[model samples]
Target chain A: MLTRFENRPHALDVIGVSVAFGEVCVIDNVSFHVDVGSTLAIVGRNGSGKTVLLKALIGAVRASGTIRWAPETRIGYVPQKLDIQRDLPLTGRDFLNAKADVARAPATDAQRVAGLVNLSQSIVDQPIGTLSGGQFQRLLLAFALVGTPSVLLFDEPTAGVDEPEEKSVYALIHQLQQNEGLSVLVISHDMTQVQASADHILFLSHHGSYFGKTADMLNSERLQELHGPTVAHLRE
Target chain B: MTYATGPGAFLIPLGMAAAAGLMGSIAVMRRMALASDALSHIALPGIAIALLVHVNPFLGGLIALVLGTVLVWAIEYRSRIPTDVVVGVIFSAALAMGSLLASGDELIEALFGAPNTSDSFNLIGLGAASLVIVFIVRYRSQLVIRLVSPDLARPAGINVPRLDLLYLLAFALTIALGLRYLGVLLMGSLIIIPAATAMRLGTNLRTMQTISVAIAMLATLSGMLLAPVLCLAAGPLVIVIAASIFFLSLAVRRA
Candidate 1:
């Protein structure tokens, strides 16, 4: 049945979402919903449409889907990577205020957001081109914090950062989730992250998928059949 | 700058430099400097067509560039094709058509410009100056946001496609303003060099923009002054000087 998820009360309610590039269908019919103050992790292999799904959710790319956000539920996003030109003279403070009025946006707003992401005030004045990988990730997190978004979406947030930094970043995100009641949707290949932070899981393949509570989704017989023995080890 | 010609000669390049310096910074930040360069060359055939039909060359170049800009915009946003390749194809065709249509002194004048002629004085100089001032004063931040990432700009309620079209139109207009002085081939150099030099020297967007305009003004003024002594055209001399400034900034950056 065709479903309309618009103007609903859920933090994010997606129904019959599908994306196609030319003749190839990247993401087939998929549907799911997340409540406020919860974390959802989307898991898929390379080319299984994980990134596309996240982009579609944020309306970055067009897709045939019914995506509804609860009224006034502002969104913030941290991309998997941003290829900022090395020569641009953009400072971290400039990045944070890219979408805000520098004059009207209080200075303390940046400080407060920076505090949430554990970023120092001094670092915000430094050029973004000079930042270390981990520092850059923290700045990206601060970027999402600027507008006080109720829903935050992160796409492979630690893809290029050091592996150890992954846990720390997710921990920061988890902290934000609890403290602000922010609905979190993250796409990650790290099973540890999936096990650690996700309240629900959406596992997608090109033609088929699974979506449910994290515990139930991990123990599914179909998931085991699809991913072989790896699924069993992922269960926590 | 001591000009052997009338004071009006200095006005055109001065205005052109201001527009190029500011707009070039946007092009550089968006990583579209090469695309801007290619688009300048695509104006050649239109100038030739205008010369053939006895119409204003600026009108012809503007029409061609607007069409080219639209084509580049369509190809870039419509599909996954890389922008440089699409613009490159159009540029090459325009260059060939221009070569076929013009020759001898006409070709030399079209490529290097003949700004000493009386017709060089136009309201475009005033229009370009106003555009530079207004753009810097108001739209700089929004333009920066759009260039940074359309994804971010969209959530901010910025109409990404419309803003992109507006920027491209402004780029075309800026380039057109310089066609009498810098010509089709060399106008893009004025647009790219000053901004690139300023980028090496700055730590923030405002500083970069300020430095870009300053460098552009210095280069244009100095080049105009030296043109008579060097027996060279002001446009090309300005480019050489701007390049020297860029390398000097690189040295400063390394230091």
Candidate 2:
């Protein structure tokens, strides 16, 4: 199903991307491309520079590389856990409205996206800090859904959510992807979900990096070489 | 150092307090409560310099605050240092330099404001207050988004760094506006206390801002009215009232 977009135009192309902090190199000379309306799952160990690469792609960090996006690319990014204070007075509605206002989307877009994410008015009206992990994840997804972005970048979308909720979140993402035909780049630890949902995989490690069709790369001997013996456990 | 009588006296401080409240709400949300207080101390050395050179102290303080805000912004961006750490370091140096330059009485007045309200000062204060209020109202959404996360803001087409600089500038300006009435030592209290109280009580963003501004204005008014009766300085009295309100808010459970 996902291979249909392979013949279409490229949504993003990254060439020779490298990121360094002081003397330590984080992402080293990585290159990959994603076709329009396709899902690319980025997998890595804890310190493998997965988040850094995403930040570099979104221009949030300085990197020496060529990151070219198709013309008129509107990106919606859902970051990992934020360090927001528990007593913060901002409600979920405030967060959504703020995104809508900044993106120049209509004022009603907040309501529209809330419906898409299955967030009730009461849930969106509560202070963001008071939200449960699952509710907050939904809120973040709803925030990303505003302005009808063409590209969605998610960094550990289910980091704080429970096990059951994780599957639902992925389902919601898949539904949105199908409906909107969005190009998605997701950083996830769930290998099973990545295998089931993603069309392509970009695995980063200190040892080496690999990017190719998900099935081809998953079945290749290079996966074992790059990921070490832990590859067997990862598929569980 | 004499207090002004009549409407200009009442109106200017009220406006300044309102601006302080609004700015403080953001400051507290940004986790700059203590840092913001420290930031006010940066104005002290400027006031001392103004006293020595016979220039308008407010002007000197304003210049210093703007420069200090820029310095904070530059250091924060360049080194990726936490803002509180940077402000704390700068503040200590500023306080030391300020105390060394000014004598006992001059230092006391600058630290704990002796309002010598002039027509020019009133006009400038009002205008600055207006600017702060307008900016907060207009760009509140962007500020809220940026506060949540800069990554979120960048994708939404908001210029995060520029907005940060602008916010720092506005914070500095609000501090400067209150310097004449609250002084460097006490001005930060006027800003932080009311907002702290509001944070305890507010259910949402709009309520938070509204409660903060109202509390700030009320404290200013009560301080102005009760100062002459209590035979005390209005600046300190204003902070006292604001602090009292904050303490009072502690009793009410957040909904």
TM-score of each: 0.91, 0.97
- Model 1, A128-228: lDDT tens digits are 87887888888988877776889998889897898778778988998888899898899988887788788889988865978987877777888888876
Worst 10 residues of 1 chain B by lDDT: B1-10
- Residues B10-61 of candidate 1 have per-residue lDDT tens digits of 7767877888899988888888889888889878888888888988777777
Model 2: how large is the Cα RMSD against the reference? 1.6
Error of 1 at A47 (Å): 1.9
Name the lDDT value of residue B148 in candidate 1: 72
Best by DockQ: 2
Clashes of each: 0, 0
C-alpha lDDT values of all predictions: 0.80, 0.90
Per-residue CA lDDT of candidate 2, range A132-235, in tens? 99999999999999999999999999998899999999999999999999999999998888988898889899876789888777676878776755466455
List candidate 2 stretches off by more than 4 Å. Answer: A228-236
Question: What pairs collide in candidate 2?
Answer: none
Q: Where does candidate 1 stray beyond 4 Å? A: A1-8, A102-108, A228-230, B1-9
